[model samples]
Target chain A: MGVAPRPPAGDEGLSALRRLLLQPEQRRIEELGERLDDPRLRARDVGRVLPEALRLSATESETGESLSEALAPTVETIIHDAVRRDGRRFADALYPVIGPAIRKAMAETLRQMLQSLNEVLEHSFSRQGLMWRLEAWRSGRPFAEVVLLHSLEFRVEQVFLIHRESGILLRHLSAPDVAFEDADLVSAMLTAIQDFMHDSFSSAGRQPLDGIQMGDLTLWVEQGPEAVIAGAIRGTPPEALRGVFRRALEAIHQTQAAALREFHGDPAAFETAEVQHILEGCLQARYRERPRRTSPLLIVLLLALLIGSGYWGFLVLREQQAFEAYRERLDRAPGIVVTQAVADGDGYRIEGLRDPLAVEPRSLLGDAPLPVERLRFRFEPYQALVPAFVLTRARRLLQPPPTVDLTLDGGVLRLRGSAPAAWVEEARRLALALPGVTALDDGALQDPARAELQSLRADLGRQVIHFGVDTPRGEIDTPSLTRLADDLRRLQALAQSLGLTPQVTLVGHSDASGTPARNRALSGQRAQWLRRQLLELGVDPALLAVRAAGSDEPASDAQTPQGRAKNRRVTLDVRLDGAGGETP
Target chain B: MRKKVCLLGAFAVGKTSLVERFVKSLFNARYQTSLGVKIDKKSLVIDDQPLELILWDLAGEDEFVSLRLPYLRGAAGLLLVVDGTRPETLDTALMLHEKALDEVGEVPFVLLINKADLAESWHIDPRDIDRLVARGWSVLETSAKTGHGVEEAFVTLGKEMLGAE
Candidate 1:
């Protein structure tokens, strides 16, 4: 075998070729074998692949579930053991995650409650609420910000600024109505507790006790280099309260640095207003805003007021309209003038002018359902000159006899009924004097059953015996005087034909150019001259009488020369006495 | 002026009874504390100056309960009480005095030998108290049962605390 090694040079090439060909495979196979043989390497390899393997297995649900099922009891036991060993550490570890989860659960619970705020007070959306909202909007702030300023989230009942080294109460401020123990004693006790806790629990005493929670109250301590400020809060405080305390303590440290450092047991050096103000700032509080409950009685009263006002307003409106319609009706009524229609308290005062002949004002309230007692009226009597009312006034004032029918057309009075001569003369005078009567015409006349007497009086009254200007004897109408003398002899013959007594009177009229006394003397001389002429013409002297009617009841318009001449002439007259004298 | 004054003593030294005779305090204040201490208040007008001494009656130092050094912090003065019947209580009070000095640096203090009414069998030698007195310590013999020297002891301590400030 020793001699056989010399023949392996060519075989060395074969070995080299074999090494190149199978070395990688050989190394890999050795690695596999070593991994199987040594548990440490095998475990390392398995550990490297375990995650990937588990991932792949997990994709296949069967192996993943089985693997987890196998691990469940051990994991449970490990967790139980861990919890049993140091539950506080476990709790602290879970704190970060548990807080939000619990908060979310609580939020969900609150959401599920979904209490509807349907019973909110009526004043919430009332005018006052609108005003409040307007104020908030104008200020450009949140409603809650405006409201929560006075609404306290928490109250810091007491604040104790304590000396660091001595634990003496340097300055203290407390909220109103908050009862407390002695501040010095409390300060000492708190410092002792702090020391006790530090000595008992802390490996290093640099960290001070921060807070103590006690049933709706919390004691917060903020430490500074020389002083510690403690706040006793009576409710849940917001996180911003931390910054408040920090800032307050910072201010105190800056301003009261000397007082804090050189503080003795007297505590008088820290009693200045600035330090007190700083401490008072530490006594922060948020006042509570109580939810105001709506009073049922108040609501009822408001409702009653609303309904009562509404009804009263409706009645007022209706009454106003009714009064308007009534006023319109009254205004339209003829001869009624509505001067003032005023609305008084719960009623109307209507003042106007009313013709006595017009319809009543009260009767005009036809369809309006208004209280009769609530209406007032003041009407003054007035005479309306309307045509119908004028006729009525004429009829009332004149009191014309039925036999003498009276008619008025455009203020002209026309009388056309038989009557005695004296009655006819009186009616003519009175009819012309009536209101709104401009003229009178009464020529048609016939005595009842006495045609001759009526014709004789008409013929005699139509004749005119004229006289010269201002003289009785000058330029007399000879033929007219002779005819008037003859008519007077006939009137004496017909006086017995009339049922009533008649008289022929020589009446004289004079021009209105002269004075009444001269005109009356001239008219009487003319009438006496005419009577003497008629008496010389063989007429009965007692049947004719001379009278003077000077410048009155002119025959025509007096402003003309012809009317003046006619007014100066004399005419025959007839009269019937009230007692029928010389009746057949 | 308010001052913090501590009562340091051995067990069964009548420190509480001495404080009760010297001050009016809320009795329930002791039950309110979970710590081994009680608080009382004694107001006095020393030299025409109004002084309020907040008396901290610490629990007696014994085998079962050790003195908590933190309670001595901020103390203006200390009342070192001893039982006249037990000689060892004086040593305990002296030890507490040194402990209090270590916690809160040098302050005024008074040594009170309690139960002096029963001094017929008193175990403390008057020479030891005289030795403490010669070292410039204010010392007094007090009787809680008869209230002898109780008010004077508190007033003396109050005056010292007020003067120290």
Candidate 2:
């Protein structure tokens, strides 16, 4: 296309050619000028940089203010248009933020409410709380309501803001959970009562029936020029509650002055925010907590009582144990029987039979916890057949010396050790006579003179008379025989002194040279000869015995003459005994 | 609309008995003994407008106790009861009317010749009641025992009180 225009590119042609050639460029330049001059074009140019400019401006507060102000309505319009087009989208976009915001606000409110209810929670688990719970059940009310009722010194249940002239309820407020009938009627009755009071009691002036009481309920009326604040209260309301009602009525009269004056059958005028608030304030309750106090004197008294009882119980237990131990001791004591052991009031009574010779019952109480004075003993005297009692009776009757030990075994009384011969004889006589004593065994019992008697018998046994060869049965040495006779006499004296009958045994021996029959005859003759000599020495003939022994049991060797002489000797044996506490 | 209506008459004139069956009572008769008045509520519709009437049944006025005039302070209407067997009760009604007029101003009122169940023994002449009726006083005969004219009397008075307002 430029080549075709180049053919016409001479002075005119060239001018024409120049015009044609410059046409596109000239049009582009003019268009560029127009675009630069046009506000719409400039606007498009600014639109391209607007976002970046705004972003930069935002970093500086001063520039951002103008930019933000410039775009404020547009931004709002765009958002508004967007919401109008799809509100659900906008709502969905905001739900996440709004939900947590609302939740936080609600949680804060709940926290504040819980703080206010802290006092209520404190009383919820208290003793008084349980009582209020019961009352709540009985009265068919809420637990919180019952708690308020009891905790409050006085509760204004319902408040009636009545137009004094019309006796119409202008506004009413009641505590939560208060079930009331028509407040209008109550207000009217209150006015009527006031009127009745004025009519009956007053001659000229007005007399308001400020208070009306019916059982636990009290209707307190506080009168103003145009309104009467009548409060139906439970429990005994303090006098200050009257002041509250008065101030409330005065406040209502002030705020609802024209309304109260022009009040007709309709009560809409008094339902104002101020009037309702004032009436609600009148419907108040005083939550005065009951004081809790613990008396110290009561605690002290209780402690003292506890300790006193404990000590008394301990003493009683100890006494009982002591009594039991004493009873056991008596049960184990021989010759002592406990038939009855009972506690009689503060003392003990013991009744049983006891042997007279046995230990005293009181003496058996060793380190007893119970005082002796607190015990009464009633014992009947009876002979105890127990061996110990029998032995005791034997000792008591026989009067044996300390050397004598009296013991009972299997119902037999045995006396051992040494004692006077006269005492031993008496014990033997009486031991068998005692009850429960079958027999007296004095076999082991020894007399005090028994040693001297045994020594005398030994001396008599040592005496021997020598004989010449083949001299049998007739030879005697006078000096030795005399000594033997003296010993026999001493033995007899000791045996008699010891309350014993003495017996003398004479033994004879012969030499081995003699024949057996001859030796036996010869030895017997020698023993008879010795026994005769003993009888002459004052031993009784009935107490003498002779025994013949052959050389088969020799004292010495038979081959030597000296040994043979020892073998042919005469010997004596002695024994003395009598059955009593001790046989001698 | 709530209206306070008062019943005023002499002693034993059936002032309280006339309204006993016609109204809902929140207070017992003990208030009448102590406070000299008992309040009862009568909710009714007149001209399609719900009207609550707080009926203050003031104790009967006699030698012992007079009409408690302050009870009529805000009364929009009155039910002046009269025992028809006793002509003297009509005079007591008239006297109570005078006292009520002075206390509560001129308000809508109805004259009830009560004990009409014993009409044969009625001593109150109809000429006298008719004369009062001609004087612009609303009058009706009512027997509380028979429940006759009892409902109409309160309705008429409730209508008059609403109409007056």
Candidate 3:
């Protein structure tokens, strides 16, 4: 590279050069550069110190008055631009923290609203609640407050005054009945929670923690500049009480600010009578009249309802048992088949198939009688081959004499009592032929003809024929002969009608004065003569038979004249084919 | 006196397990992530003073999500837990500690390296622990599984909260 010659340096030459180089504007520019070189002046450079300046301004603005007002437009513009650019990122960043918070807040608010609505509905519909509403209307108080008064039972179990800075317990007041330990610990915890809340969420103009809920208890807090007043309340308290707590805290702060601000660990200074009175005012225990302990009338009505229902159930059970027993009995009855048994109201509808010849169903209930009117029977006639039904049919078909009795043993039919021969024969045939009859027992049955024959024999025994002379050759008396002929004819007819051939015999008898042989000969002649007389009287010859007895059988005695006269006659004898003769 | 203490850590660092071991002396092998803040109370006596410690076991911080500030509002002390088997958990604990400091100011705290019973699988460097100790940070090796140092960590933080040490 080529080098140029250097100009001469002199004060006059330097002045001219300075004048030529430094115009008024150039001097101003140099002065400005020097000023810019100054640390204090360079501190104002937009690129070098603008960020720090802005940061300091931001911090100052935060501590200064109305930080939000000052930064609102800028912050809003930045937020709007960010949201426009990437709203999803912003939402995602906020979701985890804010989503649950919003959800919980909405849920809690809805739940509380629903609970209040339910309470209102429950109270408004209740009888005593109606009175409470009316009282609220009359007193011109809010319905919600009236409801709180009527239904809410609240107690300020304990009240604590805690130092804000040190978390020291300044004062504690509790209801006499409430027992708790570590009041100082509770106060410290409360203060710690408040402090935590302030530090964790250190945003501008953030409110202190207002309350903490644990099951049925709530810790209501009112934070003052120097102290925090907390009330542990059980059950829901009226909203107006929050104002009372606030007012109490304000009063304490106003009256004891110096003491509270200077308070160290000791709480003795706060235990003064005034502080005690102030804390005592926060302690409250009040119960709404325990909602009229279950009305006596309601209890009585419930008891009555229960008793009535029980009795009704018992009656139904008894009726069912009785009906079951009755149904069983009817089912067991012969020739009766129960189809259905239904209870209708107080009555039973019984449906069954029954043989008319069977025993009555009503009669079966003799031992355990049922109300006849309450039982309705729907029976269909059916032909049953049971023994009892068979017997009934047999009796109806045969219609034996009244003296005859019929009995059935298992499948066997037994006949007893006297009856006509024809009736007995017919009954035996019918009973044996009956559907269910396995056998017929006619052993006890009697033929009426036999009885008639016995009576005829007795009449014959009382009758006697008399001869005028004692000799067998003597003629019979006309009147006596006529009576003998009539008697013989009647005996022949009676025996023949009884399906038996009868033989009429005339026996010859004499007193003890005659020889046995002569008596026997005379008896033979008399029997032959009587046979001929009977033959002449239209009596069948085959029906007549002679028996000669030489006084071997005497009707009475042969010694007395009257007895001899009764014995010295030719006796009449009547014998059936299967019956032996009886001499008279 | 009652003190509200918060347990802060990354996920699966045994913060809840530590609280369980300290409060109930019980430990379970199963891991269950807490979704939100869980509050538990333990009564203890330290230095002849009865104190009720209300433990706030907060859900572990997820990379995509931050903790709710309200949950740590009333805390008087903090327990920063790290899983010894995971060295990255120490960084997470340090980050949470920074957040706690910013939100709650200076409060009593203890740094717990959890799962000491599993020292064979320890990943936390002793140098990192020494650095914390050199920085005057309270550090303890704890095991929620074997209940080692869990009570001590809580008691130490409790004592500090009560200004006893």
Candidate 4:
């Protein structure tokens, strides 16, 4: 230090540290530059830092050079870079090649594992006594060439082989593509190889790349498709070998970028550039062609069809509206019109009156006159709400029989009525008839007895008889009612029941009371009473026509009490009376 | 129609021998384990309809007692085999029946006292076989070696398998 004022440790120290920490190579170059500038300083620096293991010994050489002199700069730079800039730039420049190399190494490892699995399966299958060789073996026929390839994007690279012609002793060598370093490319290549060769073992003859042969070679290999390039060679031809390499290289290049872009998200410069040009070309070509179409005939035909369908639909809709309107008018207008009402010597008679109010207003308002469709009317005898089996021939023994809305408790049926005297006998019979009905209490309306029967007879054919009976006692004692119910059960069992059938009528009668003002009301009550009693018996009330003639036209003298009693009783009088009036 | 029922057993326990006797009324000296399950179908007139009875015959393996369990599913009836001469084969037959019960649940079964032509030297007692019958198992004594009782085993199975009263 005293002899030389040794250069500032600051610059020297920094350079040495930089060499050790960052670019050691650059640091070594700098050290070399310093030594060339001054020989004495370079020799002193080498002597201070040289390790004992690298120390110059007395070992002689023809052109002797010290070990420290030879590696001294390199050591100096390594120390200097430890203090200089970080070395990421150098690493960045090296990565593209390194990354692919690593990926390729990993894919090769995986391919080897898959090949081992296939070998194991083949050995197992052959040992199972299932597979038999189908082709004959000639004395010198080359063994079948089994080439296992690692693939990428349908591009294959040979990775393994087994040859039958070479016997079991021929040594096989592996020559992997050094440039192929993509894992995704390898996977695609494998898939394509498997798909191509799955059923290859079963082929009968050799084709290009389908089989292998001896020195008079019949080796089939896929070389860029068309030039199957089938040829015999005594040994491997240099040109043929070169051609194989070229085709394989092309396949590798094709699948490499494609598989990378597809699987690893790598973009190709050429692909990006050509894509837009191809798209523009397609668009320009399409514009020049301008797809020629049919004359306006298609549009005209379409419009015609649409309009025709619409017109047909409109006609259907209008017809449907007309039918719906006709139905509405029919429902709104009563089927029969009453034109006149007259009270004559026989009874109060009425005439049919047709009114225009019932017609739809739309028809009247429309400009054109529409034809009216006439209505057809039919009358059928009314059917009972309840079946006949529950009643049977049990109406004769009732005492204070049940009436409408009566509640039964135990053996007692309760009736609440204020009907006239003509209806009393009929009411009594009805109350006694129903099964489970033993007694009755009249609490509501009473039946019209003998007093008002005459007016009821006049309106009988006009108003339908709708009758109902109550079983208030809740228990039946009558034999006929039990027998009827039994018969109904048997009919259900034997399929003998009348299902939804219509029947004829049996008209029943009751006498009338005097005094015209009260007679009409009393007569209506008597007819209602008889209808209820008939319903209580097995005879369906729907199949019965009951009418009352009040004492206005009594069957016997009203002055005698015995005549009133006979007239007040219910009597059966059958009739076939289906007319254009009320349905009974 | 001929109602076919298979007799399955261990090697030399007379499965093929029994089938030969039943089909042809003759003894078969040679025997082999069936390679795979075989099917035989026969028809029986029930309520005037020709009802088909299909029987599946399985190969005999040492592990067959275990493998036959899954094949017993949907089987109408089973005919288990035991060698009357050697008592050990009876255990294999019992194992098969128990496995069928475990997998198929109480299917109707018949046990065969097979090779009855050699029954004079048989070691298994009659009382043990009776115990099985008492527990609702059907027992039939057959001689596949002599064609004795082979027809009766199948005819009895045919009558019982169809629910024919």
Best candidate per lDDT, number?
A: 2
Alpha carbon lDDT at B47, candidate 4: 50
Off by over 4 Å in 4: A1-584, B1-6, B21-34, B42-51, B63-68
How well does chain B match by TM-score in each candidate?
A: 0.94, 0.96, 0.89, 0.75
Q: How would you encode candidate 2's per-residue C-alpha lDDT over A1-584 as one tens digit per residue?
A: 45555443445777787898899999999999998999999899999998898799988966765577567679999999999999999999998899899999999998766544554554655677678888888999888777776667778899887778878887788988788887777778777767767777787566667888998789888878877778888888988777787767766765567776777778877766757877888777776765644334445655887999999999999989999989999978877889999999879999998877778888888887887998999989888777666666677788878877888789877778877667777777877777787888888777677766766766666666655566665567667667777777677778777667777777778889889888877788878877877677666677778888867667898999888888886776666766553342
TM-score computed on alpha carbons, candidate 3? 0.35
Model with the higher DockQ, candidate 2 or 4: 2
User: Compared with the true structure, what per-residue lDDT tens digits does model 3 show for residues A1-584?
Assistant: 29553456466788887899877878899989987788776765656776775567667844333444457569989999999999999999888999789999999998776555555556767786798889889999867667765554898989988777656567888887566766754565566566566766668558878998998789899888888889999898788889889878977986677887765334667868878887888887676655334444445655887999999888788768877898898898888899999987778899989988777888776654346789888999997987667777878887878888888898878888888877777776666666778888889888766766766766655555554435665356667667766766677666666767766566776666678888777767766776777678776677667788877877788778878767666665666775453322
Ranking by DockQ: 2, 1, 3, 4
lDDT of 3 at B157: 84
**DockQ values for all predictions?**
0.27, 0.53, 0.02, 0.01
Off by over 4 Å in 1: A1-152, A204-206, A287-584, B24-34
lDDT of 3 at A502: 67
Write the number of the candidate with greater TM-score, choosing between 1 and 3. Answer: 1
What 10-residue stretch in candidate 1 chain A is worst by lDDT? A114-123
Question: Which pairs clash inside model 2?
Answer: A9-A14, A10-A14, A576-A584, A577-A584
Against the true structure, candidate 2 reaches a TM-score of 0.45
List pairs with backbone clashes in candidate 3. Answer: A185-B1, A185-B2, A193-B74, A196-B73, A197-B73, A199-B103
The TM-score that candidate 4 achieves is 0.21
C-alpha lDDT score of every prediction, in listed order: 0.79, 0.80, 0.74, 0.44
Q: Point out the worst 10-residue segment of candidate 3 chain B by lDDT.
A: B25-34
lDDT of 4 at A339: 38
Docking class of 4: incorrect
